[model samples]
Target chain A: MNWVWLHKWGSPKWFYALSGRYLPWLTITSVVLLTVGIVWGLFFAPPDYQQGNSFRIIYIHVPAAILAQSIYVMLAVAGAVGLIWKIKLADIALRQAAPIGVWMTVIALMTGSIWGKPTWGAYWVWDARLTSMLILLFLYLGVIALGQAITNRDNSARACAVLSLVGVVNIPIIKYSVEWWNTLHQSASFSFTQKPAMPTQMWFPLLLTVIGFYCYFGAMLFMRMRLEVLQRENGSQWSTTEIDRLIGEHK
Target chain B: MLFRQPSELVNPLAFFTLVGSLFPLALGTQPDFLRASAPGLLWVSALLAVLLSLEGLFRSDFDDGSLEQWIVSPNSLAILSLAKVSANWICTGLSLVVLAPVLALMLGLPGYCLPALMLSLLLGTPILSLIGAIGAALTVGLRRGGVLLALLILPLYVPVLILGCGAVEASLQGLPITAHILWLACLTVLAITLTPFAIGASLSISVTE
Candidate 1:
């Protein structure tokens, strides 16, 4: 089997070049989508009959929550790739993705609490989704803590990889068990397999924001990965030449 | 082998009992309140005690270099780590299970709940030991890993805590507890089959570093 394609993706230099070329486009797309989606969601979307304007928080809360969970899966997959292939880029991806996941989780929890106050008459409840999301926040903190505790870079990355993999396996079990433990909140409002109960006006911008959040995540990851790649590859000929060329262009 | 150091076995059991006693004192010995809160209180205490003991699970061997030798041996690291974790379960987890009845009585737990408590602890503590071993192995090389270990392992312990407490709660309400026990057993089996390799891999990383 041809291994060149695999090697190309694995190479830090190739990733650096490719990500650089597309970084501006990703940034522009994400900024535009996020702006348009948030503006439309906030102003144009009709208010809920029951909830009125409080439900506007769903646009941010839903996207952040979705991104929080999906980013974890991405972290685990990247970690697995690094472990199996020993790819430097995969390790960078795993590390860079974690802080972003943490922020997303925090945003989800904060917005959820804000949304909860007006809707549920309290800022917090032992609802299953809230509890699970809190646990996800802890899980993210654990990954970040473990990565920092170890002094060795490669060892830390691999250790976090094993941990995220274990966490991914446990995610389903945790979700179900927490659901069983208590479920005071309403059932899910959005699902891929089922048609949403709300009209398109309410959900369309939500869809846009979800996609926008993903693009934003990609842009963030690529930005962080590029900086990390340059840091790790410092003093190497290609990196030095790249730096010199950029400096020359700036001058 | 763990029995040689009696403190290793005794400390966690003592911690469990001490933690169990504090609840009644703080909550004012009201039997109804105690009875209602007994299941959750007992499980949380047991979980903390198990986490406390896990800090030392591999510390001695890791310090003395036996962990390195075991890794390099012809025998599989997974099996070797499994043996180590099993010894830990017997010393700390089993002792907690056996000692829980006295604590249950202190907390005014009903007689019918005792069997369910014992059964749940029996099935659930092993899962704690197995999963905690992975955290212990991961942090074996760090100088200050105790708090970090708890942070890493506690979130993973949520399902066990929920199921174990749920089993006892079910018995309290005269509900069928077979489902909770069955789920706990399934979690134990999954942990047994999967965590040993994680423990092995984590140990290799810690030892090599």
Candidate 2:
């Protein structure tokens, strides 16, 4: 396959222009998808026979949980690319993704806990998924903290890359161990999976919401990457000219 | 070679002893409580002792500019990194394994579980050193990386900690400790196979910065 497109995306100037064009589409589509999915999930989807309305939280919980895990995967994959190619844009993507991943993990935990309150009769049970997510949050915090602690930007990015990659290697092990530890302590919950044993009405909106979350992440990622490109390339001729063009358009 | 001298070994060993001894006083001399908690207590203490000494893992080398020298050496950095990790395990990890039973005994750990505790420590501590060395390498260039290093690595340490203490706990409960021990062994093997490259890469970034 011809590789011009790959190298073009790797370049900050091209990426900045392409992402700017996509940003408006990303923002409008994600916002619409999220609103429609949430509305469908909350009002139209049938409630659980056992859980009643509290199970509605799955709309938010599963998407955030999936996003949280996938974001970590993205961080590691991007970091590996950055390290291998010495791609500044990939490094920026890696650095930019950490805090968002942490927040998504936080949302998952919060919603999981709240849902637990009504369903499990307690807010927390040290459940396997929750515990695993907690550890992931810590891992994200570690990446973010390492970045902040180091003074040099390039060093910090590479360091964070190496650190997150290490964390990525351990991610599966952590999930497995936490899950094993959980089973040792308690019986398993009815986890939501792609082929979950639920009615179509119950699971359909969840599918929509999951897709919506991916769109949301894509939108946010491109927006942040654009800002990162401008900041890192502030003095470059292309970025300066682009900034002037934007200023002229606004004026 | 910095840790070859007896004095260098003594510092962490002494600190290890002091940490292990203080637990009984802080928690009181209740034998049942001590026995029940001994595995976790000793494991946590060992984990901390290893972490405490990790500061020295690359600090001296970085300060004296030897880290850069190693970075530019003709040989593979991953192997060199593994060599340092092996040295660290021998000095800190092996010492902790040796000291664990004494601490176990001090904590009134049951007689039957001593072998289990030793085996757990033997399998677990090396994984700690291997992974911990990655954090140490990442932070070696920073002026204040001690606590930051801990924050970065402790979450990753959870699996090994669980398995190590779980082995002893299983043995004490008259259950099969074999599975837990096996898990620890597998993790150590995985760490051995992979962590050196990670440490070497991080160290290259650190020293080159």
All models: lDDT?
A: 0.94, 0.88
Candidate 2, A1-251: lDDT as tens digits = 89997788999999998888888887787788789778988998887887788889888988998899999999999889988889999999998888889999999999988988877878888777778889999999999999999888899899989998999999999888888776422332224543567787777777778888888898889988888899899999999998899899999
lDDT (10s digit) by residue, model 1, range A11-92:
9899998888888988898898999999999999999999999999999999999999999999899999999989889889
Q: Is the docking of candidate 2 incorrect, acceptable, medium or high quality?
A: high
Residue pair clashes in candidate 1: none
Q: Which numbered prediction scores highest in lDDT against the true structure?
A: 1
Candidate 2 residue spans exceeding 4 A from truth: A184-194, A249-251, B2-7
Best by DockQ: 1
Candidate 2 second chain TM = 0.96
Best by TM-score: 1
**Model 1: per-residue Cα lDDT over B26-143, one tens digit each:** 8888788889999999999999999999999999999999998998899999999999899889888888989999999888888888999999999999999999999999999999
lDDT of 2 by residue, B3-116 (tens): 567777777778888988888899998899988998888889889988887877999889999888898899888999899889878888898888888888888888899999
lDDT accuracy of residue A85 in candidate 1: 85
